[model samples]
Target: MNRLTTACLLTPALLAAPACALDPQPVNIQGLQFYPSLLLGERYDDNYREAAYAAPSSWITTLEPRLRLVAEDRNSAYRLTYAGAQQTYHDDSSASHLDHRLLLEGILEFTARHRLTLKAGYSRLEETASTAIPGVNDEYSLRTFGATYRFGAETARNNLEFAANHERLRFHDDSLVNAREERDASRLGVTWFHRIGGTRALIETRYEDFDYVQPDSPLNSHNLALLTGAVWEASAKTSGRIRAGYQRKEYDDDGRDGLESPMWEIGLDWEPRSYSRFSLTTRQAYDEGDDGADAIKQTRTRLDWRHEWSERLSSTLFVGAARLRYQGLDREDDLSSAGLTLTYQPRRWLELALGYSHWDNDSTVDRERFQRNLYTLTATGSL
Candidate 1:
């Protein structure tokens, strides 16, 4: 069934249950619990011939609305969220169009810790002048039933969860040629808290399986990803983490070789002063096809620094660079990005931020040169 019908059928009955209800609260006539942000931005990306620069010179705007209603009892919770964004861009110097998106999502949680939650969501995306290039994605739906299991400290103290998600993707070009993908993903992870030398540390690890659904014609592929990470804190002002992961991707209909990639990273953090903190990170990854000789290598290094001038003003600066090499490709393209964010928070619940980013890519394919500049402004508030 569609999201609207499912919501209509489940919302009323679910709200009426006396076993799981929240504390009573006054309802806002506007249904406005909070507003996250009103964001506006502009970007320019050139050199579509060689790199992943899909568009050039685009303007953007976004608004996200959130609401929550509490019942009189202690067992039920309801949340509603909506987002709208629009973009206008120039394509190939003449083909230009505006794309708009609307998304609506609702969640109802019950039984407190048991947390029987149901979600209904829908989104509509439309492009004015593009037909073949992902113009519109209409009618996506999700249904999930999930529960958590908890164990005491002696055996394992962690939250275990299992969820099955059903999603439908309808393409604008062929309305009837719809795709339905379902995944049963589970997480087995552990978290630990410790204290040593007057400081506290937290560690976590998880393994997940992402299963997919395809039509009888065998139109898709599915795979598994393994994620593991650890964090250590030796002092009140210093902490760091190490992470390693692997993912395998396969596609049946594409007639291309499957891919397996592994990545590892290590990082360090330091707060030399109360007003500022710095972090450094390095990562390496390798992507290989079934044929071992055909492989790609990537290395990334980054540094970030943030400072607070006062209670109401703060700023952050980040710089990063990546080098990627693909087999059989003689020339390698180096990518570099840097950005700064300045924030003004006059109140605890409200904030305003402005950001700018610049990226450059030099490609060996015909010596193509690509560059992009982005500027953004955002204001967010909560009550």
Candidate 2:
């Protein structure tokens, strides 16, 4: 199955610890720093489709290439990033696919106190069709643009931030079985921060609107959220952010029911020693759904521990669990996942990692139950 990824991807259970990798030197070209990198990997998945019965195994080859250009002056900074992934299957050629993404981001320090951030991105994504059509793939395009303005300086005691974002999605309907799907989303938000010593207290409010292309679709809704949070660096060994609030979703049509939930996201990190670190992250939110399901309430929690065995070798272990509650359908799912990775950095320009992962899903519907085990070996390098 095709997956969404950037240069550094954080899987459901596993987190990336880039601090362990030695930085590769970037070349300068026309005042811009250029970085080019490539990754090659081999994977064996026993249940690639997550099917409960008649599971198929496959050996997959994966390739990814990335390019980044960055330029920064005393007043402004700009960046352009591109990445692509190609996956080919040895047993199921039909599952092989390629994905691409491009992003442009910039920051303008219009007088330090009145700064602005801008970003735009485009992605061509392919995902495996739902269980009903397990053999096919659905292709789609996503376009996004966002901006943020901050009205405070480094020494300011109080700060205010305003942000806005817009996104559009379109599905490719090149085949007879493919039906076009499209959606547009827009959001506006504001935040206030009060600085107190090494910690910052914050309050934010946001409003979002979703519109579906289908006439009078029940999926159209308006969302509102108010959150209160804090960001803190307690000491040299501890730092993190925690946010909690309430969210409500109201449908455009009165016939369909709405939803309200308590939302929270918390991430904490601790380093008892310089060579070992631990992280805990958790989140609760609502997501759109398909297949006769109107919406899904999801809660997830994960923990990661990374320990360095030596100057050049390290290991990381991650475990996570999730609960999915389906709205407008009498179905619920519990998920458990774990992963272990051993990384070796033998040279300044090369890194190798061997990893294994297990994922299990138990659902109220027997057809949705499955367990998967995957083994992978990956090598990354730069010239």
Candidate 3:
């Protein structure tokens, strides 16, 4: 049998074996709890750089270890997690690298109905050259902090939330990408929600500011948005949210024109059967671009379905499409992707997964069109 066919058949056979020993449980030190996990995986990518022509394929082996710590009381909770990964490439040794991520989150209840949520995270990772400028592997560090406060009784019909977030992105090798692309962004928003029958009506307004490290950058801008939406729980089997709004961006440079676009987001989750679930999501927004453009207006839609095949086996299928239009240029790209993943968890702390994905891009610019495929097999164990 071919490699693909043999792999497909072997996965199910291994999962169908008798149950194995249970993994070690979490460890508790005083009031803090810790859970540790390790993941080993192999992935084959037909187009590692996502080049339009003459794509180079590679085989990658990954080793990841993660630890999570949590502490909770009657009115307060705290969590900290750290994950690191080392990846090795068979043919492309220069592309191998180590990645690290750290996240801290907390929730505090000051009063009976007043609560605050906070989160901070830092990550250092590398991305393929196609996703960035200069056509080389790019390494970057990202830091983010956010906080939200909610007021009103939990049983009340009305509530209000105020939130603020900040993020900074820095590149390690500035020669591969422009230092002007490094930026700091801040966002402040407020939301009010009122319960009406089984639905919650919400109105929100947000302000965002983007500042580039380079003074001569033309991409620095401020954005304002006003939105109204509703969240409905029609039944136990269906829940969803829909929001529509208008956004306006003002740029710092007079040579480039700003943009005003209609913004919207929608999401739905439906479970028609006990063992099956469906999800639908769509969004329209403006994203930062590293191609010396002001921004990229993007609209994307996705649909996902998950079903349980047996007690220890489940499968998920997803398809998505996106359209990206460069604000200050006549460039547009249409992209689509589809993927399927099968997972098996015969033991509480051991899991295996197999996945395949296909991606296609059609751009107005000829050099941006490409098709790619990926196959992955992973096994994870936790203690």
Candidate 4:
């Protein structure tokens, strides 16, 4: 059987074996819950001169399944969750492949002074794409494993969290007979939260390393990045964060030297009232090139607002824009996108959402535009 069939068959067993089953009163069965968000949409794009590029048409449907579980007792608790999703391209040619992703997480909570929790997770992503020769396909896959430890305070003025993630990617296809390489990435992060005189502050930092190895091409490269950021809550209605980072990359691929780049970000989160929320964020990033190529600089910005009108209906609007500047190639690109989402929740277990999005891309090399409209009707009931 396929992946979808396997998921459907295992749903029943997972629901029946929650953590609260061991308790005498059943504890309200509060640990495990399975909810799947089904998505369907249509997309259209104009202008495609290259046949190698995959262009979207006007209709597509996607299915995503998400599950959450939390088992707790007096001194210890365990949690497990999984998410699986797939999207098939009904492309302008009907000759494309499907994209699939799977993720699993496990957590262990220990009762201590700081309330420490340990986590381990794994994720896999696979993609199928069309090839130059008909009936031939290109497939790529990535697998990731990670761990995290989080600590919190019940009534004190301190919180600490640390996490580490390692990811590996492997690419294979029928078009290229001997085209396989391994890409590994490692990330470490730490965050501290402090409360002083009713004012909340946070400090966070992270380091990441990426390495790529290829035996056929005899190429090896690594990039190391460091970032630090701080957040402060001035009032109930206003909060913001700022971060700065630097990266150094070294390569042994065809006489490529070392390079360094810097990046920065600013973000704001605000709530005007109980029913309205808004956010504004912007980032500037630079990336070093491989094989003696010129570096790239990118800038991104976004604005999002959500308003709840009533108990049954709520609307949200978002705007995003991005610009990219390339060195040596003298190419400049810009993109602007807007999205609107409306949600209808008439019952505690049922919800319906409708969304619309439009994207515009303009560049010195090419110009393209696309519009996506989606309507989702969902119902969920459990006893």
Candidate 5:
């Protein structure tokens, strides 16, 4: 009867269920906002590389196009997005590929709590290589800028926030995984909130900095964190955000050795009825390692379920797990996954989906142990 008293006695039957209509409803012009999408898919993979021995299987065909644009007012907001893809493989034609992404995001609310946020992105990817080397086609670019300030007001019961952020990452192939890890990251934070009936209690402190571009890279790092958190919403039929922390990572390379961990992030959401819904997530982190490990300490968990068995049927389920550790290598990895999806939205812009997934990896190095299975079929439209 623990687990926070069984999640506070199941939060009133998960907030009296009912909420799920998974997004998508946009299209307007003149006030500018649009969402256009098209996807057609087919996939089957029983293990394409991810090998522990003779494993190669494939059948793929996918075409995707997506777009989103938005514009807002009153304070300011804007967004732009695009996604493109084309994949074909039939006998694993060199793992056929073409992918692209573009994004821009913004927000500026100069007053009513002050804010500014902006992001930029570009991507082109194709990857597979969890250690047996060989697999690449990556291009990346990203930028972010942020600022926020808020303090008391708007029905304040003590609230405060201060944030700062800067990020940059770029890589355009630097000799196939040996030195293409460019990076720059920065963060500074402060938060404090208290209001305890219907919950909201938070405390945070953060500082992070990472800079690298092969400066004799051992993944130069710095991190410091401290957190304590809570956020709950009951009448909304359950809501969650949880944090717990103490993290420290420092390395300026002396043959790598610096870490002090115990960090966590958790999330939960529930809607016990009215077409069912449930979600849970967890994390513990320290990452920046892509097979040339010098850092990677991860723990992840996830669970999700959704159901809407009428008005055009729906279903979803997923489960996940992960654990990896390697920071100067003694290597360990374990991963597991499960998935299911079924959807049919007979109208309102149509959609059809079917999916299945399974993956397993357990390694202590053995060609990175592997197992995989995936099947998918999809169709979507909305313009």
Candidate 6:
């Protein structure tokens, strides 16, 4: 839906929807619980357009209203959600837009050992000026469907999971008609887990196929990855997973170079105190390139710390760095970013947050380089 439709549906809901049920609780409708919420935010962006020179600043306002319906029984759980975010720029109307998403998911456990999970989602999203030609906003829609099945329960000695997913991407802007950006991608993967005391030793195999609708889709390719990982779930103070693997991506056009790279991912969380936590994550992976390259290899790492100062106040700090190596192109980029946020909840159903973030990007292509800072104030209300 567009901004008008979203606004029309959101106005009355924000004012009266929560009053439908009287007990300060979710309303019961058709055997499911209904939850409604709204978020309002105001932001000041120093570089809203992501310009490399003569950057302009703007004040932005965002409104989002969401509703969720959920049902759960002994054997199964199901949920449905819809959300729309509309953004308006005080100085740049051309940069304003509305984004909408819908999602549905269900989990079914027939027995203690067999479980099936399914999900599907659709998003009408916009690619802001950063990904476009500096002045254009690229619009696209995505539809995704996926399912996963597990063969063993938590206490079992071994577990097996089978997963499959498909995605369809379509561009809406006429400026992208010849860009050949529309495509379909499918992935199939399986993992085998062997329990080793408090940890699990695992191996995974994945295959992916990409298809483009444009004639002579030179970027069409098949990819494969073999990975081995270890999982140590929540324990006394620490939990995390590490995986190392190799991936090979071959393209349909022999003239264009392919990518064969080593990949690894690490994630860990430590709770040193009852009111504090620290998290670290790192990843090296490949993403399909739309910037005149076959693919891009990205490496990044981040660290975050969260502490609760009081029963109703909390703060978080984070820093990150990344590098991008574009395959089939001589361009490279280094990126650094940091952010801090403070949140307070004076009441159970209301929350407020203030945040500030900064980004610095250095690219071999001059047009892609920029530095930006943003400040925001946000509030959320729910019933």
- Candidate 4 vs candidate 6: the TM-score winner is 6
Which sections of candidate 3 miss by over 4 Å? 1-24, 129-135
Off by over 4 Å in 4: 1-56, 74-78, 86-100, 106-138, 150-161, 172-182, 190-205, 216-219, 252-254, 286-296, 325-331, 367-383
The global Cα lDDT (0 to 1) of model 4 is 0.54
- Candidate 2 Cα outliers beyond 4 Å, as residue runs: 1-20, 129-132, 173-181
- The segments of candidate 1 whose C-alpha lies over 4 angstroms from its true place after superposition are 1-55, 58-79, 88-219, 225-228, 232-235, 245-258, 265-270, 279-302, 323-334, 346-350, 366-369, 379-383
| Candidate 6 local lDDT, 112-163, one digit each (tens) | 9999888787889775546545656777787878889999998998999999
Clashing pairs in 1: 20-75, 21-73, 21-74, 21-75, 22-73, 24-72
Per-residue CA lDDT of model 4 for 45-126, tens digit only, reads 2322212234433344455554555565666555566656554445533433455545454445564534444444444443
TM-score of each: 0.55, 0.92, 0.92, 0.70, 0.32, 0.92
lDDT of 2 by residue, 260-319 (tens): 999998999999999999999998877655445667788999999999999889999999
Root-mean-square deviation per candidate: 9.7, 3.4, 7.3, 7.7, 20.4, 5.9
Model 2 poorest ten-residue lDDT run: 7-16
Candidate 5: stretches off by over 4 Å: 1-51, 54-195, 200-225, 249-256, 260-262, 270-273, 278-280, 286-296, 299-303, 308-316, 319-325, 330-336, 341-357, 360-366, 373-383
The lDDT of each candidate is: 0.50, 0.80, 0.81, 0.54, 0.72, 0.81
Model 2 TM-score?
Answer: 0.92
Q: After superposition, how far is residue 95 of candidate 5 from its true place, in Å?
A: 34
Worst 10 residues of 6 by lDDT: 1-10
lDDT of 5 by residue, 274-329 (tens): 68889999888676665567667788888999888997888999999988887777
lDDT of 3 by residue, 199-266 (tens): 98999999999898977777789999999999999998999999899998988887767888999989
